[model samples]
Target chain A: MKKRKQRVNSFMVNGLLLFLCLVWTVPTFGLLMTSFRDRDVVSKTGWWTVFTRPDQAELTLDNYEQVLSGKTITLVDSKGNQQTVKGDNLTRAFLNSLTVSIPAVVIPILIASFAAYGFAWMDFPGRKVFFILVVALLVVPLQISLIPLLRDYGRLELTGTFLAIWLAHTGFGLPLSVYLMYNYISQLPRSIIESAIIDGCSHFGVFWKLILPLSVPAIASLAIFQFLWVWNDLLVALVFIGSKPGVEVLTQRLLYLIGSRGQDWHLLCAGAFISMALPLMVFISLQRYFVRGLLAGSVKG
Target chain B: MAGVRLEKIEKTYPNGFKAVHGIDLDIRDGEFMVLVGPSGCAKSTTLRMVAGLEEISGGKVLIGDRLVNDVEPKDRDIAMVFQNYALYPHMTVYKNMSWVLKLKKKPADEIDRRVRQAADILGLTDMLDRKPKQLSGGQMQRVAVGRAIVRSPKVFLFDEPLSNLDAKLRVQMRVEISRLHTKLKNTMIYVTHDQVEAMTMGDRICVMELGRIKQVDTPTNLYRYPANTFVAGFIGSPSMNIVSARLNFDGDTCYVDSQNLHLRIPDDIGKKVRQYDGKAIYFGIRPEHIHARETNPEAADNFFNMEVSVVENMGNEVYLYFTPGNSQYIARIDPDIPVRSGDSHEMWLDTNYIHLFDGETKENLIYKPKTQ
Candidate 1:
């Protein structure tokens, strides 16, 4: 009787997980199918109908080609608003997103790891007070600072450059990054740090060689969260970089696609997937460290 | 190599809790000194203070006649092995051993040479490329030791380094560490709560209790002449049995008189113990000192009837537990005697190996301080 009950329990758990996965994955699958069909067909028929009427479904790579090759497509909105926005430059936007994200992730990790080391191990006056202040900054909303920061950028004459966005993201991303990194770095065995110190390693050497290498799981997980946030962020980039040509990110370009061509499901679906490609690859590659980092400090050897 | 001296060294936390009292010790050059006690005895704290890992709240610490109270751990020229064997989880055994030398900017060839030599000594050449996670517990312990030995520092500090291993491995590593001490001859201070490790490994053992030094003596001397009740109870396995008794005199013969036990004190020591006549005292004897009368009937000066409550059998020996007076006692006897629970037997007390402690102060009445 006990074995039978356990079997039924496991079956229910598996059935629930399978149902949830299908619910989550079906929309992305539908978007993928709609991206390949003709725009007229996507509007007339549901994407699920392709499986029923395979012969009637019109699949093409033209949407991806046009999105990537810089072809201009004009669309008319409701109430006859005609906007002739260019359909190309996503490749350029991808590069701009990289330029914004690489430094945003790298800069904060470097600074936060140092801050975490000092807060965790080094002895100084007001150390506890300073660490509490950093942790307290996590509750402050970043949205409230955008307008004030933008005005500061205006006075500094740095409104249109990628530097402004990088700095904004770094400032906004630091508190969480420092808190997460401190949770990990402080949980490290105190004896390991003391052992290194006795091994003739100065504090800087210990941080550079020992602590940094041991903290790879934490850094990897933090990098993923920050990278995906900056890559997919529309508000921060729109506020700081301002949709300027050659500096606009993927999210800005995707927004422009929606604003100008409200009915072009083919173009919108293809563009959304293009913006998601890098983040998907990143999450998949670092999935191991992500799980380990999340479970750290809660479990012990 | 250099001798370490602690002059009234003390540790007090910011919360005003004293972990270590002001204690003095002198570790001579190339001596293996083991600081031992039960948990919360602050033996590890005292060792850390000498290594500069812990700040000494008061007094001075000197390494080889140089004041090191303000020096950093690395500048003090000492290496420490932690209880958990804090080998870097990321580095290979080779890197873990060579890291200190590299940090000191030693030449590449010299670093390689030293690491290889230490690895060879530890039989870790085969494991040089493996991370700590891939090694067994004993192997990781050897790497921790190898990490210390490559530095060739002036002194070595070990904080319960073998407590993490299995029982068999603990005994093996205890012998190996003792052999390493003999081979290197560096001034070493080791801290452990295991008396077996202290007795087998230390050139001289310092027994501690309640943040104070109870006794410091050789293994034989510590067993034969423990300075107080605490050391007498702590240093032996199946610890020495101590019970409340009274000293009384019938003419010239002095006897330790209790509710169920009456044993005479030897004449040579009776003169000293006679001072405590008519006063409450503590009567202490070890397990091995209590024997079965059949084993050696020739030297049975003090014998008593005890009903055995529990019997633990070993292949070579046996342990018999019984309550003869107010306190329970354990006797280590020959397995050939065939003793069982619920059976009453005549047990012999070797009065020559007994101790008498003052009831109020707990200091052994017959303790004679070593002049050295």
Candidate 2:
């Protein structure tokens, strides 16, 4: 009876998980199908219709090509005025996203890892208080800092550049990055670090040769998080870099594709899928590290 | 290889808890010195101070003739094997052993040669490519040792290296480590709470308690003549039985009198303990020293009858637990002896091997051997 109950319980759990998975994937699946369907069919019926009326399974790359090439767009500015923006620079916007994200991910992680090693292992005055201050920053809302930072960036003439967004994203990502890296690095066996020290490794040598290599899983996981965050971020880019045609990221261009009236459904579907592509690939490729890194220092190997 | 010297070394934490009192010790070159003590005895603290892992709150630590108080662990040229093995989980055995040489920028061929040599010595040649997580506990421990061996450091410090293994494996590794000491011939300072390991592996054992050394002597002397009651009870398995008693001298002979037993002290021991006459003293006798009267008829000098409360058959011998008056005592008798709980038997105490401690100081008054 106990075994039968356990079997039933596990079956219910599996069923619930399957239900949740379908709830999540069904909309994405619809968007994917609609992105491939002809524009007329997408307008005429829901995306599920393609499955029943197999004859309407007409698929084309026209929407993608149109979205990728140049096209006019309408966007609402911060002062609540609608403006007509020219040039559908989707490829340029995609490159802009890459430009903003790569450094935003790499710089913060590199800096955080160094800071984490110092905070975790190196003994110096005010180490504990400084670490506590960094951790306390985790609770501070980023929204409060945006205006003051943008005002300073304006005065410094740093606004509306890829550098501004990169700096913004790195500043925003640093606290959690340091916290996560510290949690993982601090739990590393004291003996391993001591052994490295005794093995003639200086602080930088230990960090570069030992700590960094051993922290691949953690770094990969953090990279995925930071990349996806900066890639999908529309607000930070709009605030710092603006929706100017050439400087705009994929997410900002994606909003431009929607237009102010939200009537370009077919183009919106295609552009959304295009923007989703890189992050999906990244998450899939590094999903293993995600789980391993989360569990890294929680248990002893 | 270089000897290690700790001169008046001490450790006091920031919170002002003194973990190690002022200690002076000289570990000879190529010697295997074991620091044995119970938990909170600060044995590991002293070893870490010598390794330069812990800061010396006071005094000096010298490796050879060099004062290493300000030296970093790497510059001190010493290797240590931690209790948990402390192998880098990500690195293969070869990389773990050769990382030091790589850090020093040794020639590629020389690094390879030294790593292979150390691996061969540790029986880890075939496992050089395996990561620490891929190896078993013993294998990981061997890799830790191999990492230390590749450096060929002046002194090898081990902090309870075998305490994590099972009993059977612990014994096996104990002998293996002893053999490693002979083969390497480096001055080694090992810290452990197990006196058996200290006894079997150490050329000399330093017994400590409460951050103070009780006695530092060769294993035989430590066992035969412990300086105080703590060492007497700590060094031997089954422990030496201690009971409250009074030593009285009737001018002709000296006798130790406890509740239900009156034992005449042998002349050799009595002469040494005679100064404490008419004073309370702690009587200590090892379990093996008490025998069944029937086995040795010559044990007639100090004999008594008592009801056995418990009997443990250990195949070769039997342990009889009994209460004579208010004190409980254990006697190890031959297995042939017919002793059972609730049964009465005649037992003889070998006064020649007895230990008498001063009631006030708890210092061994009967046998005070010179420490080496």
Candidate 3:
């Protein structure tokens, strides 16, 4: 009876999970299908219809090509005037996003790992109080700091530069980054640090040669989070960088492609998929660092 | 190699929990000193203080003649093998062992040579390229040792380095470490809660309890002449049996009078303990000193019949546990002698090796401190 009940429970659980997965993925799958179809077909028919009658809708690469190549497309205005518009392409914006995200991720992790090492191993007066203060900063909302920071940035004439966004992101990401790195660095067997110390390793040497290398999993995992956040962020970019073609990130570019009248909404399916591509690749490739216990054989079982 | 001296060294945490209380010990040059005790005994804390891993709250620690109270661990010139091994997971065995040399800006060739020599000593030459995660527990422990020895530091400190291994492997590593000590000839201090390891490896064993040193003596002297009831009960396997009894005078002969039996205390031991006449005292004897009556006909006194409650047959010898006078005691006897649970048998206590302790202080009445 127990065996039968467990079997029934497991079957129900698997069915529920399968249902939830389909529920979550179906819309994204629909967008992917629509992204491949020609703009006219996308507007006239639902994306799911292509799966039923494969020949009903034609798949073309024109949407992606136009979005990527930055070619100008001619649009007839409502008053019937021909207006030549530069295509809302992500070519420059993609590079802009990389510039923003890479540094935003690398800067915080470098600073945070050092802060974490100090917090975890080095003994100083007010160490606990200082760590608590850093942790307390986690509760302070970024929205509250945005205005004051932007005001300062304006006075400093630093607005509309990648440096502005990088600093803003670093400040915003630091508390949690330090907290995550601290949790990983502190739990490392105290003996390893002590052993290093006894083996003639200076404090800086221990941090550089020991703590940093052992912290790859933590740094890698945090990189994925910070990179994804910075990549998808629109509010930060809009406020700091504005709609400057050269400095705008992918998310801002995608938003701009929606047009002031929302007439360009059709292009969104392809635009959104293009933005989703890198984060998907990032998550898949860097996900293995989440397989914890890199410390497995470093300490006795 | 240089000797280490701890002159009234102490450790008290910020929370005011005192871990080590004014511990004073001198470890001779090139000597192997083992600090052995039960859990919470502060043996590891004492060793950490010597290693400069822990801050000394008071007193001083000197490496050779130089005071190291404020010195950093690296500057103190010591290498420690921790209980968990603590090998760097990201580094290979060779890198782990050679890290300190590289830190000191030693030439690449010298680092390579020293690492290879240490690895060969630890039998880890073939495994040098493998990461810590790829090695087994014992192999990781060897690599940890290799990391320590590569520097050839003046002192070696070990904190229960074999406690993580299985029993057989622990014994193997025990011999291996002793052999390493013999080969290195550096002043070494080791800590463990295992008395057997203390006996087998230490040139002198320092027994501790409740953050204070109970006794420090050579292993043979420690076993034969434990300073107090705690050390007596702690140093030996199967432990010494200690029971409370009344010491009485019976017309020039003295005897221990307990619930189930009365036995004369030999004159030499009696004279030493006679000061406690008519007073409650602890009667102590080791398991090996208790024998089957058939095997020892010479000891006509101190024989009592106990129904054997448990019989442990250890092939060459047997351990028999029984209760007499409501106090449990173990007796080690030849396995060739037949003994069974629930069977009542006569056993003889060799009064020659018996110890008497003052009940209040638990200090061995017959203990004669070694004159240094």
Weakest lDDT window of 10 consecutive positions for candidate 3 chain A: A258-267
Predicted candidate 1 versus true structure: per-residue lDDT over B8-41, tens digit per residue: 8889998999988988888899999999999999
Angstrom error of the Cα, residue A131, model 3: value is: 1.6
Collision pairs in model 3: none
Is 1 or 2 the stronger prediction by lDDT? Answer: 1
Compute DockQ for each candidate against the true complex. 0.46, 0.39, 0.80
lDDT of 2 by residue, B53-138 (tens): 99999999999999999999999989999988877766778888888888888999999999999988889999988877777778
| RMSD each, Å | 3.0, 3.9, 2.2
lDDT of 3 by residue, A68-157 (tens): 876456899999999998765687889899999999999999999999999999989999999999999999999998899999999999
Off by over 4 Å in 3: A1-16, A71-85
In candidate 2, which residue ranges exceed 4 Å CA deviation? A1-5, A37-44, A51-60, A71-89, A291-301, B323-327
Local distance difference test, each candidate? 0.89, 0.88, 0.89
> Candidate 3 local accuracy as lDDT?
0.89
Error of 1 at B301 (Å): 5.2
Q: Once model 3 is optimally superposed onto the true structure by TM-score, how far is the C-alpha of residue A290 displaced, in angstroms?
A: 1.8
DockQ for candidate 1: 0.46
Over 4 Å off in model 1, which ranges?
A1-12, A74-87, A291-301, B296-301, B324-326
Chain A TM-score values, per prediction: 0.91, 0.87, 0.92
